[model samples]
Target: MEINGVEIKDTYAEGFGIKVTRILVTAATEELAKIAATEATGYGTSVIGCPAEAGIDCFVPAEHTPDGRPGYAIMICQGGKKALDHELMERIGMCVLTAPTTAAFNLLESEDTLKTGNKLKFFGDGFEKECFIDGRKVHSIPIMSGDFLVESEFGYKDGVAGGNFFILAKDQMTGVKAAQAAVEAISKIESVITPFPGGMVASGSKVGSNKYSKFLNASTNEKMCVTLKDEVESDIRADADGVFEIVIDGVDEESVRSAMKSGIEAACAVDGVLEISAGNFDGKLGAYIINLHELF
Candidate 1:
């Protein structure tokens, strides 16, 4: 199939079930809130190496925020519950708590809970106190910047991760432009986050290593490598010179599917976009299969 003259490859993105939690970081101003959110989500592009996969989900207005201040909603995802809990304490304690005029709150409601604030409140020693913000229970931990409030019990739920698509272009510059357009379009969708830098991955990886099988879990995707096109069995179109992969994580499978479709359409609208494909391990690595052709 084709979209705007761009070929839609008959492949699917392999996605797996994971744990997800959304936190709201509010501050005196929008800029401050963004800083806290950015810091908390930093170095969280992929779960392969990073302890967590996180990104800013959306911005919340003052009226909607618990402290009547502007805030950014961020999602932190992990492959398991313990990892998510550990990452929540580390990120929120080190990043959000350190930020000026910032407070963290739970943005999602789920039956499963993580004692995030309970663990971090110890930073206050004996001075920590239980408090309520906007009718929600929280921990008021005194800090040099007055007090840092964090939700007592952060809610967590199962989420979908690794939903991705690749944009094949005539050159690196064109691939970047198309990927940027796709990321911008995906940003409009709610309950989804693209954790990569600028929401695109230039170095796509395949499962396992050809040589260092014990030390390396993955290696460069040679099929997407223009230089290795002739040497390796290439997946890129004959005219394509570069490829960019955009990976998406969402609250559920439907949101991931929607983001993939939206990103694909946006990429196809860009000039020199040769094809849209996806990464997968023959549907063995994940529970969800997001077919690129089915998206259209």
Candidate 2:
């Protein structure tokens, strides 16, 4: 398949099921809200070295926020319930709660469960109080600047993780430009995040190890590397001289597919972009293999 002169591989992207939690961060100003939300979602690219994958979900204007200030919604995904809870406590407490004039709230609601506010209340050091509104519990933690309010419990749902695509270009600048275009395209879509470094990972991995005895999680796709183009399989090799990968995580297969399709379309419109591709295992994650052609 060709999109605006760029080749689109007829392959699929594989992903797995993960638990996701959304939190709302409000602040006195829009800049503060952006800072708090970005900080809370920082360092959460991939689950390999990080506990979860997170990013700014959306921005809400003052009229939509409780404090009449700008706010942002953030989503964090973990492998399981335990990891999700732990990450939520640490990130929200240390990042959002500590930020100036910022407050946290649960974007999700549950009937009977362990609430995030209940875990974060300890940060108040005994000055914390709880309030019930519309049957939802909110914790008020006294801070130096003001009070930080957070919801007691957050709702968790199964989400799709690791939907990805590759942008092959003739040079680093071209690759970067293509990736930027793709990011901009995907950014407009809801419920998806490009969680790699700077929302794009230059170095992508394969399924398993080819060498290195002690390396249990080493999988290198030499074909995707320009320097190793002569040393790997031709099918996976990039026709261009440079390559970059965009990894997306979303609420479901359709959301991911939509994001990927939009991103690829945007990237392919740029110059020096030769082909668009995806990363996947051989049916290992059969539950969420989004076909590229079907998406386009």
Candidate 3:
């Protein structure tokens, strides 16, 4: 199948079931809110080596925010409950608490709970105070700057991760441009995040290492390597000189599919993009299989 003359590979992107939490970081302005959200979600791309995968969902205007300020929503994901909890605690404590004029709140609205401010409040050394805002418990912890307002609990729920697709181009520059366009498109979608640096991955990986090493859990995806076209059973085309990937984690299958569709369409609209493909583990990796064909 082809979308806008860009070939859609006859394959599916494998996904995984993971625990997710949505956090809202609000600030006096959108800029500060973005800084806090970006910081909190930094270094969180793949769960392979990182503790979690996170990305900015979108911007929330002052009228929509809890504190009547600009805010940014981000989703943090981990393999399990404990891991997700740990990620939230570390990220919120270090990132949000340190940002100027910023406050954190729960955005998921799920019954399942994760301790966010409740854990970070201790940073106040018993001087922390509590209050109720619109029926939700919020804590104000004193800091060197003043006080940091944080929601007591963060919402937690099961989410889908590892939703990804590859952009094959005739050259590296073209591939990068296409990937950027795709990322921009996906960023507009809600309840999902690209996670990776600049929302693009130049070094994609496969399931396991070819040379089994104690330090390496996964190795490079040789099939997507243009240089290895003649070296291994490559999936790269003869004319393809570059390959970049965009991986997404969403609150649900629908959100993932929606983002993927927008990304693929945007990528296909770019010039020099030869084809669009996805990474899958023969349907063994996870229960969700986002078929690229079905998307179009």
* Tens-place lDDT digits, model 1, residues 1-296: 99889989888899999899999999999999999999999999988888889999889999998899999999999999999999999999999999999999998899999999988999999999998877898999999989999989999999999999999999999999999999999999988999999999988998889988999998898888888888988887789987899999999999999999999999999999999988999977898988887877
- Weakest ten-residue segment in model 2 by summed lDDT: 106-115
- Candidates in order, TM-scores: namely 0.98, 0.93, 0.97
The residue pairs that clash in candidate 3, if any, are none
Candidate 3 yields a Cα-based lDDT of 0.92
Error of 2 at 135 (Å): 6.3
Q: Where does candidate 1 stray beyond 4 Å?
A: none
Cα deviation at 166, candidate 1, in Å, is 0.4
lDDT of 2: 0.82
Q: Write one digit per residue (lDDT tens) for candidate 3, span 25-114.
A: 999889999999999999898988888899899998999877899999999999999988989988999999999999999999888998
TM-score of 2: 0.93
CA lDDT, every model vs. true structure: 0.92, 0.82, 0.92
